[model samples]
Target: MTTEAETLARTVLSVENLSAWYAESKVLHGISFDVREGELLTLIGRNGAGKTTTLRSIMGIVKKRTGSITFNGDQLIGRRIYEIARKGIGYCPEERAIFSSLSVKENLTLPPVLQSGGMGDEELLEAFPNLRSRASSQGTKLSGGEQQMLAIARILRTGSRFLLLDEPSEGLAPVVVKEIGELILRLKARGFTIILVEQNLRFAKRVADRHVVVENGKVVDILSAAQLDSDMERVQSYLGV
Candidate 1:
């Protein structure tokens, strides 16, 4: 766990006036936020409030986006998805898009290693014991928790220092949700900057260092984990939880 002072010193990603579109419909209307190195932050809001679009825009997956996304002091306004990934940003969407046609091991080894220092086979297995046991199992055969684990593990193998995870704990059982929470804390300790999109405010509270509350396609509030505790009522009103 990093102190607030330490987190502020590293500023990793800055999103300024970011607007995005799905065809002609605007989803994110000039939302702005910053992510600090080694910090785990969450974008929390009701469904359709544009949290997913925010992550997609930062990852350069949303093509019709307009804004200045500065990462490590470089502007990422018009970079392609692969270009952004090569620059060390990994995205694990809500769908947990691991290939259903392949074995777990095959899915793990498929993505091109974008940089050095990625987790090797041993490390990946150690972090996720379920995957270790199901190495040869077909992707579709695993449980939802296992699939989410595989999605996260595959990204860790990419050596990407930054990660964008959308709704990782959604539709998960209580025990499995707890496991995901623990894994997120472990990744933060390993020094990965993460921007998470989560609807479960309780789960978000357990894992994130800060929370950015979105409503109607824009940033309505930003609170530290400490601030969130003292101002729970206000934030809950925004989330309608």
Candidate 2:
């Protein structure tokens, strides 16, 4: 069993009583969670449950946010989005933001390095082999799976230790989804801490160490991967699946 001291030592990000809003509309309501170093945690819920808002709140994208967001011992609540990113936190939005004008290679190398630990070009190419073949192709020219891979690959080049991935498996084929899952597992093995926002429960169960269930903008339950099997009824109710 993991001891308290070990868990404390391993925690890389902590969010307590986090609330957020867009313009006048409130989204996340006093949600709290912690992501341990190198652990893959997923935020699971149906539409409008505020899973995406929680990620936006963490990245400092949501301007009107309350409560503590501590990452690597640094307070992130008041920081700018770019500043938060500079602190080694990366956000990959649901849209899979890939610059259409830039080639795959250009897009991959475009992000300014945030830290010294980023993977080199060759290493990155090795990890995402599909990228190497499409090096000269425009970013928007790639298929959905390739675009998703490039979106994530660019972040790896930025040297971000903690990644906030939103809807990575959404609208992808089963084979491609499996590939993405394999990639996530590889990242976890390489010590990349990730918080994934996913509506796909099957995909979440495949890669996440824990699941944080959200409903009506609040965290309703936290379950381990093991507990997921036995607690399906409750999970389904929260997800309305």
Per-residue CA lDDT of model 2 for 112-131, tens digit only, reads 98898998889999999999
Off by over 4 Å in 1: 1-4
Backbone clash numbers for all candidates listed: 0, 0
What does the lDDT come to for candidate 2? 0.92
Instruction: Give each model a TM-score.
Output: 0.96, 0.96
**Candidate 1's residue-wise lDDT over 1-241, tens digit each?**
3475865577899999999999999998899988888889999999999999898888888899887899999888798888999899999999999898999999888878889988987888888889988999999799999999999999999899899999999899999999999999999998888999999999999999899999989999999898898899999999997
Per-model C-alpha lDDT, please?
0.91, 0.92
Candidate 2 ranges beyond 4 A from true positions? 1-9
Clashing pairs in 1: none
